[model samples]
Target: MTLVSGPTGGGSIDDFELFYARRALGRLRSRLGRQGLLDLLAEDIGKGEAFLRESAGLSGGSFNVGATVLATRGSTAGEFVAWMDKAFADENVLLAAQPEHYVMAGQPDGAVHIVENIGPHVCSFYLGSWSAEALAWAADAEELLPEAEFPHKKASNLFLADGTVVGRVLIQFGDTDDGFTSSLTVYLPTACPESVLEHHLRHFAVEFRNWIVASTTARA
Candidate 1:
C-alpha cells in the first residue's frame, strides 16, 4: 500500500483513507506511559500496521511507517484530558462541516477511546513513554485461529489520520523491515459521505499539527 503524511502545512485527512491507514498510540500511553508506547511498538508495530491497512480498505503492498507523539510540557495528568479534549473537537480543532461525523470522545480515567466512527468518530489520545507489559496480544494470532494461505515477510507501513496524505510519505521508506499483518476494518454505521469524511479528517489533522507545533515550541 502507498504511504502518505497528512498535510505538512495545513489540511485535514480529507481523502486520507485513499492512501493512509491511521492509529493512535497515545491511548495506550495514557494508561501505560512512554514505556508503554515503546513496549507496544517493540512487540508488534507490524501487527498494528497490518490492522490499519486492512481497516482503511487500501490496496496492499509495502507502506512507510513512522509515528509522532506530542506532549504538553509540564502539564499535570489532570490537565491532559482537557487539553486533548479541545484538540479533538473545539472551535480551533475539529473542522468538519457535518458535525455528526466527527464526534470527539473525552478520555476516561487513564483509558482513552478506541473510536466508533461508523458515522462520525474522532478518537482523542495523548502520547508519551512506553509500557513494558504491552506484549503482542494485538499482534499474536490465537492457537485456534486460521493460518495464512501463503506466508510472506512483514513490511513497513505508515500510520495516518484524517487529512494526512500519502504523497511524500511512501517515498520515505528505507528497506528490509517487517512486523505484523492483520485485516481489522470498520463498517459504516455512522458513516458520513466521502466529502464529509474528508472535511472531518482534515479538521483532525490540522488540529493535531497545531498542537504539536505549539507543544514543541513550549518545550524548546
Candidate 2:
C-alpha cells in the first residue's frame, strides 16, 4: 500500500518500501488468519498466472524499477560475488548460477525473465551495449529466456543455466573497476506483483552495499 505504485523518475526502488510490503503482508496474514490469507492468495495466483502474457506491458513497466548502491571502497567483481554467494549459502536459499534456457511460448515451464546488473553502468535494455555478461547472456536471448527466480531478499540472482524453476535465485554480476558503480535489474513476470519486485530490487541494492562493507572490513 505504501509503494510508489504509479511511476517515478530514475525508477529507484526504496529499501523501506521493500520491507514494508513483506511486513504488511505478514500483518495481513495475522489479521485475516492463515486460511483467509491463503484463500486470497490462491484466488489471485490462478488469475495472475493465467494471464501473465496479456499483462506483459504492465509487468514490463514494473520491471523497469531499480536501485543502486555504492561500495564503501574499490574492489573486484569477484569479491562482491563471493560475499553474495556465501550470504545466500548461509541462508539455505536455492541458487541457479549462470542460468540459461530456451523459452517456449505459452508455458509455465517458465513464464518470465529478469536481469541483475551487479552495478549498472551499461543499460540492459540496450542491445550489443550491455556489459560482457549481459552481452553473453544476450547471445541466448532469442532462443531462451535466461532462467531465474526473482529473489525476495537481498543477494544476486542465480541465472539458471539449466533453466530449472526449482530455485528462485537469479544472480548476475557486473565487472566494474571500482565495484562502487555496480547495478542490478530484475526482469519479472506479470504473475509476480510489480510492487513486490520493486521491493526485492531495493533489498538487493541495500544488501549489496552492506556486503561491500562486510567484505571490505574482513580483508582489512
Best by TM-score: 2
lDDT of 1 at 49: 32
Cα-based RMSD of the predictions, in order?
17.8, 13.7
Q: Per-model C-alpha lDDT, please?
A: 0.30, 0.38
Residues 125-199 of candidate 1 have per-residue lDDT tens digits of 221111222212214422212324212211112223442211111101111223222121111112224543344
Query: Which 10-residue window in model 2 sums to the lowest lDDT?
Result: 120-129
Residues 1-220 of candidate 2: C-alpha lDDT, one tens digit per residue = 3545655644346755655664665455447643453354554433433343334434443333344444434776566666654543331111112111011111132222322222211001111112234335324323222233211122222222232221123234444444434545555544455565566566565555556666677667
Candidate 2, 149: how far from true, in Å? 25
Model 1 poorest ten-residue lDDT run: 166-175
lDDT for residue 206 in candidate 1, whole number 0-100 = 46
Off by over 4 Å in 1: 1-108, 112-190
lDDT of 1 at 150: 14
Question: Which numbered prediction scores highest in lDDT against the true structure?
Answer: 2
